[model samples]
Target chain A: MLTSNRRLVVYGIAGALAIGSGAAFAQGAVAAQYRWLTFAVFAAIICVTMYVTYLAAKRVKSASDFYTAGGGVSGLQNGWAIAGDYLSAASFLGIAGLISQYGYDGFMYSVGWLVAYITVLLVIAEPCRNIGKYTLPDILAYRNNPKAMRIVGAISVVTVSTFYLTAQMVGGGVLVKTLIGIDYEISVMAVGVLMLAYVLFGGMVATTWVQIIKAVLLVIASLVLVMLVWTPYGFSLPAFLADVVGDTKVQAKVAGLLGDAAKNMTPQELGQRFLEPGLYFKAPIDQISLGMALVFGTAGLPHILMRFFTVPTAQQARKSVVWAMAIIGGFYVLTLFLGFGAAKEVGPGVIASIDAGGNMAGPLLAQHLGGGPDSFLGNFMLAFVSAVAFATIVAVVAGLVLASASAIAHDLYVGVYHGGDIVPPQQQVRAARIATVIVGAVSISIGIAAKGQNVAHLVALAFAVAASANFPCVLLTMYWRRCNTGGIVLGMVVGTVAAVGLTLVSPNLTYPKAVRAASQKVLDGEAAKRSAIEAALASGDAAAIEKATVDQKALDKAVTKAKDDMKKVEGKEVSIMGLEEPLFKLKNPGIISIPLGFLAVLLGALLFRDKRSEELWPEVYARQNTGILASKATSH
Target chain B: MATAPKIDWNAVIADPRFQALHRRKQGFLTGLMIFSVVFYFLLPIGAAYFQDLFKTKVWGVVNFGILFALLQFVVAWGVAIYYSRVANRDFDRMAREIAADYEKGG
Candidate 1:
């Protein structure tokens, strides 16, 4: 034990250093911003969290604590942890950016996210807690069917968690690089190292506290920012919101972002416009698909489901959800205020100049509220909010790493490879800790690879997998007696295939290339025409001048023609991959894939009905219906 | 894990008391799930199919769309809190009773 522990420590330190050194080689170039205050705040946060981890490490003596914090977490604590876990940097920054840029359409994600908890609360929470042990597939394998189910379960959990982990890492890199003069790769490594440390030593207990602390910070920051935004108008929320919409500068930015529909409106009219839909989500199908993805996608998120195991008893699982829903629901409402606050407080011009993606709205708003961007207080607030974002990312990434690692170590390694009874507890825990380092390192590398990528789309695709592939299997296992190995496998395959297939050919992948090339061609032609005119002017000939001016008209005509050509194919079904048109147009695949996922389960059950599935029903039912299996539930 | 619950769950499942418990729990859970599906989908569906109606302003700056969107969070919270209360009072109690009844060979 002593020797292995020493080896583990050596590995942990080596992994941490590897992650730290990794940030040195990333492809990020935006190192234009730096603030010592942000660094100080980040250092302070690291100290506090390291202390929390030390506390958690001392207590975690077994696999149970490593995976589920010994199932001793309180409902309220779990609630906050879930909120922290659920509200990724996307929720903190992206949703606010969406609302700031797109008006009411941005809040759609928040609403969908909040309501998703109802599905978890009502359908998944109690059952998942009751039927499973360390991982979700624990429930699927509880009835003597571990081999295929565990493997599939492990794969889905790892896939979803890795995607989530990658997104957090990318966001971390972008955020840190933007806030301070660090390389994006280095920032990603820093996040990875810290995330690894948390999972490696502290396990679920430390991860839970990290999340809870971050959640508190996030909510408090949002609340403070909202108050600062509203206080300027004497605390009349209506007046402040109207001012946010009514600001002439805001109108211009809105017009620029969304076109003329948002331009030249009176305060009342602009307010109404902002409140109405269609700022970002232009199509009916797009909005519906996004909504479907957010609602169903959340249910299958491995990190979120993994949280339920941290609390003992199915009842606490149920209670934690209610607590989570309440906290999450309130936090989302506050995010609306944060969105509006950032829009009004920071202003979009500053937001865009800092980051074209508008990701700087929250931090900029913090700066603006604390006096000005350069003020001591401004830097302080900015640093505080930035640290909250860092904590948020770290907390979420830690959970993802822990979960996927457990899926590997608990479900696949011990439960599947070693069969049910072969692997010892100590070995399992050791494997899980090692798995954390491996998963964290892998995600950090992927994070470095995806350095400058738009993580929003990646997150959406992850959601697609979660909803269609992961959730369907989990739902089937919990509710359907007829759902056998074949049914589960079919559901996962169809769901994953449909989602990935649709996304591959979807407008998301196709639109950028065609649009960029077409628009860039027009700009290049216009630039050439202007330079030729400038060349003609240098001759100082009256005839040349007149000829050049006349040629300008032709150039204008050419530009018009170019624009017309681009418009004709703007969103048309044009082949993305050498075909006449892309096979899929919808940006989100959830609406199609989720139904396909369920259909596959039905078809598989009917077509390949397992003879022993009926025989296993008694045991499955027993596990789900009572607390009697609680001991067995904890065993594996 | 040690000494599996000796109660005959097959018999318990067949018992009317267990059946009632299962029926009640399933009914409530399924009912909430369906309601959530419809309730949550309405905003997206309404935004898609009934844009004009959703755009209609109910207040000075607030439109039906924003109101409906915000309403979802409220309704979701209401459903969660309401379900929590109901489950604590009803479903959990029913489950405990059924378990006890089975153990006692009722």
Candidate 2:
């Protein structure tokens, strides 16, 4: 099916990945025990999900089924799916980890995510369901030049989804390595292959079910953790909170972790300070920027938006948003308890020692709550939570892949390249499958290559892009009367460029790094000297070998020092633009970029006047509001 | 799918019921959106500016800041529930009638 050149490219990529991961595999370390328990849980999960996939595969007959599950998903089911898709490993692991380390400051980071859903329920959800079909671009292409709108929309979807997918993939791999004993490369490969199976075979139907299952599991697990955490305090909320802030043991734990940073503060001061804000977000503006991104960006996330299309009516869509808000809001509330519980029970020092970013806080707490690491209950709980986290990654990534696949296949390949013609449904489904494979392969390769790198910022970057690029166009096209094809295109281009451009120059990227050229020169020269000494020491001449051995020890010490010096200077020596710091101090660009997006949409519409767009405005508005002439749910 | 009835766009927009629906819905949505945005931003702003006030303990380990933050969840849910009820009661009925009238006219 593939051309020789394409096959060669695929083979070349595969070969590079093999060789790259092979090198890292040699040094791979596994942190937790009871590998068999993790494997057993993982096997059970895969079997159940794959069986659901098999059932879904039989029902997927046309492009509509592949894209929107034939528009048959119930409101409650779709809401669960949305919750599952939106709450990735980041929400479950990352937020808990942050809260466990930073206390109240970490809890502040989570509040915005739940409130953002109100924006979706009020402004975006129903209109999107009424106007869209199969993909997000359908809303734009409804009243604009189909080719231009679909193409641009497809690009935006791919860009946001790719950034998000990479983060999930890398997180999944690292967590598997820590939770189970699997090598990172093998875990990444396994996750990628499993995701491909779901998207390529079962399409949206299976993705939705996987998400529902994962959401239920994640929620139940969090609830259990929360209950177990508070039970020690006699299930009293006030008592728990009091203990969190007043317990001498907790204060000692915090003081020990703070070490030199504790200053002259006593246990009481540290305990009281732990319940205040300003620990994680030292800069007020940074918190505002992050808030802006979470609030606005969630409404624009392509995968989350795509879920709206799976249900039939705008009413159902509206109901789903309410359901999602409750479920997601409850889950986020649970994180507060989980984080503080982990802080008190597991201790920040132990948490940081495991993963440094506190990613292991939730699972580690589970182990502690089940009776310490040496107990069987502890091992079982850890394995169960870790497996749930793994499932969370798979469900989220599958949703992303499906969204981008629809963007590529339904929006660009069929909508644009086919000149907006009605392609055969089977052909469209086939195209979507092909797109799934391409998207999966590309994200997997990037994920493997980005191993062990700090990817927490990628999630924020995705949200910023979605907020800046996609949200503006969707809002303007639906609501603005004079919004033309030119306006939509220009808005997308300008918004994307502005958001990405600002990020490039923001502190997110412009932080210091050691001069690569100088560092590499010293390292390469030292490596050569060490090799020379190693060669001489390998010979049988005792005196020469003894002298070479001394030289080898000196070379080794020099290399170690050189590496340490490089690490120390990484964020101290220089920045990309040869400046001490970036001009843009805000880490997340949403506060500025979101407004710039709206301005671009306004300017583009005013500048590029199109009579046809204005003429069609009434019909588009009526359909958006009243849902007349909207696509019906496809009957099986 | 049945062929869609041809309708006058300007006339529809000019219709009293349609205008009322649009006016009421927009007024509600715009006001709520503004209030929510401002209310949402108050978190970071209040936390930044009112540090001493926010740090005042209310109960055992509870402080003004944590209570305020937690109240956001309640506020968000309140807004959603209230809006959905209003939309279902008034907006949906008005929109439906407008659609039925248009169908008859066309």
Candidate 3:
């Protein structure tokens, strides 16, 4: 315990050192923009989280406490923590930016994410908590041959968790770079170290409190910012909308994107743009696909599921989920406004200049509405927003790291390597910390490689993978009576491969390459025309030949220039125009892939169905009976 | 020819701490669930109505969603606490009663 405390302190100091060095080296807008009060507030939140972890740690008498908070957590706390875990930087920051840029299409993410909770309630959450030990593998291997099933389960867990972890790390780097102007790699390293400290020293106890504090702080910050936006205009919503509508650039963009017909549309029509698909009638199908990806991907996330185990009962699990959904749903709705408000106030040109992807919309909006970025109030708000974004990344990454570490140490090491022999609790904790370091290193490496990529898109890819791979296997094991070990293993592999393979080859992945090629082609054509024009003047010829040659050159130049300009405009227009269709098509492949996984499991079960002992059915029934009795006996 | 297995009441109610823990957990859970259900339904509508009344547009939408989510979590926490207290209390009482009966050889 002392060692754990000491390690936590050391890790905290290391984080401060990293931040301090980065702050000192930062230049221009970021250097003078540091808000001491905001940093202090962020630090205070971390300290509070640490204290919560200490309390939890004191109660951790067994591996159960470390892994599942002894299954004693209340529904409300667990619910908030789960929400905190699920609302990553992508959802908190990315959603609003997306809404601002894409109109109604962006709201699809919120609906998809919120709806996933229903699936969780129906299929995965309660059953998983009821049966599993520390990880999903325990549930998979519950009745079937334990050895092979455990190994297969571990592999699935590692694959999904690693991909998800990479996305969080990449987001962390971007958040830090945007907020503090630090080197992206350094920011990634800073987040990795902080997360490593969190999981290694504090374990789940630390991770949970960090999430809870973050959720509260995020809510408070967003509310305060929204209130401030209203304060300057006497708290009148009509006045605010009038101001937003009066902005010429915002009006122009709205008109251009929505068409002339949108100018006369009602507010309800405007709001509905976010809710219904096909509102952007001219947009490609990828836009619709992107919307679906955001919506469905929320259900299959691993970090989100692990949070349910912290609570004691299935009922608490259910209630907590309800709470998490409400909170998450509310947050996403706010993001839509934040995105639009920033676009209206700051102007799209400025936003595009700062970050073409629009991840900085929230902070940029704060600066525009509150004061200029250099003003004291503006700087403070900027710092606060940056700190919130940073904290959001850290909180989410910590949960992801813990999930991966548990999969390795608890599921793989104990379940597979030791043949499920009972290991001492202390040794298990030690192994978990070591696993954290290994996962942390891998995350840092991925983050470095993923620099300059869109964090949200990468996160969506992670979601697609989780939905296709882990969700099917876990869902089937819980609900399907005929599912055997072979079925679970094969389904996980097939789903994982299908999702990853499709995502790689999908038009969405290849569209960027095509755009780049188009740009190069335009540039090359211009160069060739210029060289030919210069050569035409140098060559001497007969009058007839020269006249024909000059005419040909002029004609060729005119043709080349027209084509080049067209290509340039087409490249820009098509890049934007082609955006929605490819993404929508790419995203749906997961829906098909997920069902395909179920079919794989069903087939495997049928093939292996006859091998089942009659004893298996009775044992399953007995376990259910005992579980019910246990619940009743305990619930006074 | 066949005998039913005897009930192990002693095993069922052996732990003294279980009752107190169970009761506290139940009370906490009941309160939490009630709070969550009420707030979850009310808050989103409240936020939406408030946004509509004020015409806050983008900020209004964002706030409504965020507040709803936050309120739901608060309710979940309340429910979890209620269940934990009830479960601990009932289990402890049963355990103590069984232990006492065993001591008396009843």
**Among all windows of ten consecutive residues in candidate 3 chain A, which has the lowest summed lDDT?**
A621-630
lDDT of 2 at A318: 84
Best by DockQ: 1
What is candidate 2's lDDT per residue for A1-636, written digit by digit as tens?
Answer: 224323433343344335323433322112334656765776677778877877787777789899999899999999999999999988899899998888887788888898888889888998998888888888888888788889899999999999999999998888877776567887787788778877878899989999999999999999999999987888876688877777554575456446578889976788877788777787898889888888889988999999999998888898899999999989988999999899888777667656768898999999898888788888788888988988999899999999999999999889878987878978998999999999999988988999977788899999998888889889889988889888888888888888888887777753444344555666888866777677888787886585565456545655665676577566465565666667787889988898888888888888987776787888888878877655433444
- Cα lDDT of model 3 by residue, A86-154, tens digit: 888877877677656654445444555665565565445655665555676766676666777777777
CA lDDT, candidate 2, residue A62? 88
Order the numbered candidates by DockQ, best leading. Answer: 1, 2, 3
- Overall lDDT per candidate, in order of appearance: 0.77, 0.82, 0.62
Model 2 clashing residue pairs (backbone): none
Candidate 3 residue lDDT tens string, B3-102? 2233343343233433343344346444643444344434324333443532323454333333344344444444434444544455334434543443
Error of 3 at A169 (Å): 1.1
- Candidate 3 at A136: error in angstroms? 1.5
Off by over 4 Å in 2: A1-33, A247-264, A513-580, A631-636, B1-9, B103-105
lDDT for residue A106 in candidate 3, whole number 0-100 = 52
Superposed Cα RMSD, model 2: 8.8
Query: What does candidate 1's lDDT look like per residue over A1-636, in tens digits?
Result: 544444554565556445443444322212224355665676677767777777778777788899999888988899999999988888888888777776777787688888888878877888788777778777667553578889888888887777677778888888777766468777787788888877888899999999999888888888888777776779765666677767654664555455455556554565456666766776778667877878888888888888988887888888789888888888878778777777777665556556656777888888888888557787788878887887888899998898899999998778777886767667878999888888988998999998766566778888898899888888887678788878888888898889878987877664544664776687786886789788987879886685566556646765775676576566655454554445787889988999999999888877886656667776567557665456344543
Instruction: State the lDDT at A406 in candidate 3.
Output: 80
Which candidate model has the greater lDDT, 1 or 2?
2
